[model samples]
Target: MSIFQIKQKTSGAVLWTGSAHDEKTALDAMAREAGYADYASLPDQIRAGGVQAAKLDLIS
Candidate 1:
């Protein structure tokens, strides 16, 4: 286990902090931040529904 911190790029404030075994765990936090998707739901949506793509492409 190791320490992982996720911070907002512009604000420079720590947004989330926890311990995980590897990078895969860290990405889970990122996915949650993007839209609050849980582990199984996040990748599933990304693989088929393009949740991330649609989020980024949102006009407003």
Candidate 2:
């Protein structure tokens, strides 16, 4: 699995993080959690950034 960071496009806030087999799956899941209509429209609301290994502590 790979870790992905989903950030708000306007605020650059880290909104969600998780591990998935692929990036698309991760983004889609995060988008849904953020209340977007669909993954296709996620890019407008959030920015998908670098993929990392799952960490124990993400917020600091």
For candidate 1, the clash count comes to 0
Q: In terms of TM-score, how similar is model 2 to the real structure?
A: 0.51
Cα deviation of 1, candidate 2, in Å: 0.8
lDDT tens digits by residue: candidate 1, 10-37 = 4555545666566557657656776866
Residues 1-60, candidate 2, lDDT per residue (tens digit)?
666776655566676788767767776777688687657765632345532323334465
* lDDT for 5 (candidate 2): 73
lDDT scores of the candidates, listed in order: 0.51, 0.61
TM-score for all models, in order of appearance: 0.45, 0.51
Error of model 1, residue 54, in angstroms: 27
* Candidate with best TM-score: 2
User: After aligning candidate 1 to the native by TM-score, how far in Å is the CA of 21 from where it should be?
Assistant: 1.5
Error at 38, model 1, angstroms: 4.7
